[model samples]
Target: MSSSIPVSTLRRFHRSTLHPRNTSRTMATKVERSPAGEGADFRPPWFYTVARVLSWTLIPATGFYGVFIYDFGDHEHVFQPARRWAERQKAAFLTLSAEEKKIVGNETASTKP
Candidate 1:
């Protein structure tokens, strides 16, 4: 009974299931290179300059200050002063009447030295 099956039919079914149809979507496009890497010498944008300066100077300075001073003690002790300051600020802001809020808002945009 096994000999009744055709070998060619089994081979055709196995080949179709094992191999997928090739398509143009599977092909990769070639990249064109600039001669002597001329295009690679382009200057970074203005923000890139700002980011470089901050990364090289401001960020490190801020980190040093935070670790050495702002977070000098345990969580409760170190953050107590900042928490009190924030509470005072909130209380002062809340105590301000409508006119005071308006005045404070205006002064924020003022060019006073």
Candidate 2:
């Protein structure tokens, strides 16, 4: 499970690769200059600006529309059907338990103090 490479091996590889044959020549980076006046100022294209605006605007607009649809546009309207269904389910369970109690007939005494 050892993940480390030997330090000696790394040092050897670094020395072989970095030490060039001509020690007199130092590695100075060469700069290639651009022509005259092109690429001095940068301005984005028209469609790019439009795309960025649309992306930002559409994202929030979609979120607002989604919320609006959930709130007032859908058939049930703001989780009302869900609430009513839950209440009906609870009532049904209570009625079924009451029938079971009538059938079972008092097996245990009340434990409340």
Candidate 3:
């Protein structure tokens, strides 16, 4: 009167139906390569090599020149505001009384726990 199959019966049924006993061989075959220098190994054109070498040389050279040689002088508008602010702060610090300078210096040196 039981409707459920046993675990062994279910496993045997799954093994026979879900998986085949023998697998079929594949139809694909491997391709044979052309021998040595008959275009098996290819070299790029001369200009491509020259362009690659120039790119490797010129890009780093341009970056180093920009970092070390190029100067903006008075035309450096981006940093001018910050430079002016620093100058004003230095003037203000110089104008402070000796006691005020001591207080400011101590405030910066003290760390809060």
Candidate 4:
């Protein structure tokens, strides 16, 4: 049976199970966020958002969605939150730096595979 399973797949499954799924949302909002009026510029980093979702089986909220942009200068567009990414305060976001805070702040157009 082990031979039929890819090592990577096994690792992923094991990791996910180990983290355990959160049954926080059975019907209402799937994700959660900080209360209104925390920080005017309060938004989570991109990687941080992803990590938050990945880390949890179900995201508590969907405050803001960001898409990665290429250029790294004045031409570059970044940090836009239509919703709130306040939930990032959970371990997944706090670790990031201010610069990271900036990049992730931008609204993402796509997360294409």
Candidate 5:
């Protein structure tokens, strides 16, 4: 190694070392956002994942409530003893007149031969 220094290069370095710096302006700043560099208007991949999970969870829950919890299956009706009795009473009240019964009996007698 050599320990020699040049005179002209030393003077140029001394001149630049004393220069002033600007302190009036500052660097720009912005709000924090997603890693994809999208602003508030952007929808991330995580949102899609959460929405899919929510939809999948809710669909089965809705079906369960509709099928069991809400008792939509019980909306259909079946005839019981009371209904049968009422229907029998209605038929009895609407029975054929005596003249109609006589005519039916005459027809049966004629058809037997």
Candidate 6:
């Protein structure tokens, strides 16, 4: 079987699927002045502008304070339980006999393999 189409068939398919170019004069027209043309010169109220500037300034200031200056000590209460549990674990490990610690180390190594 020939896997070829005639050039005339391709041209006919393209012509049938192609959209017509826009010909309306309104599509090319530009408005001289809009109904709300007075708003073109509008500026936000003084307080609104001030608030916007303050918000933008505070956003970065707050981020910088949190990252570099904020005392994490003030929030330690939130992690107190986890911190206490870790301290207890460390103390318990410290109290273990040297032989017990060696056994733990050996067990840990064997578990990995």
Question: Who wins the lDDT comparison?
Answer: 6
Instruction: Please give, for residues 1-113, the per-residue lDDT of candidate 5 as tens digits.
Output: 55467867777766555334322221111223334455433665699799999999999998655544453343453434445576688898889779989999999999996
Off by over 4 Å in 1: 1-48, 53-75, 96-113
Q: List the candidates' TM-scores in order.
A: 0.27, 0.26, 0.28, 0.18, 0.29, 0.26
In model 1, where is the ten-residue run with the lowest total lDDT? 23-32
**How much does candidate 1 score in TM-score?**
0.27
Better lDDT candidate (2, 4): 2
lDDT score, candidate 3: 0.66
How much lDDT does each candidate structure score? 0.65, 0.61, 0.66, 0.48, 0.62, 0.66
Q: Supply the TM-score for candidate 2.
A: 0.26
Per-residue accuracy of model 3 over 1-113 as CA lDDT, tens digit each: 66588989988878755566423221111111555554443544687799999999999999766654556574765556666686788898779888988998898889544
Candidate 2 structure lDDT:
0.61
Candidate 2 per-residue lDDT, tens place, 1-113, comes to 66498888878877755567524333211111334354332343587799999999999999756654345643666656665676798898777476588555544334333
- The full ranking of all candidates by lDDT, starting with the best, is 6, 3, 1, 5, 2, 4
State the displacement of the C-alpha of residue 38, model 1, in Å, after optimal TM-score superposition. Answer: 13
Alpha-carbon RMSD of each model: 19.8, 18.8, 19.0, 26.1, 24.2, 19.4
Question: Lowest-lDDT window of 10 residues in candidate 2?
Answer: 24-33
Report how far residue 69 has shifted in candidate 4, in Å. Answer: 65
Ranking by TM-score: 5, 3, 1, 6, 2, 4
Model 1 agreement with the true structure over 6-80: per-residue lDDT tens digits: 999888877655456533333211112445454443444687798888899988898656744564555466556
lDDT of 6 at 32: 24
Which portions of model 4 miss their true places by more than 4 Å? 20-30, 33-113
Residue-level lDDT tens digits of model 6 in 1-113: 56499888878867654435433333223222434563232444597789999999999999766655555685665556666686788898779788998999999999995
Q: Count of backbone clashes for each model?
A: 0, 0, 0, 14, 0, 0
Q: Where is model 5 more than 4 Å wrong at Cα?
A: 1-41, 72-113
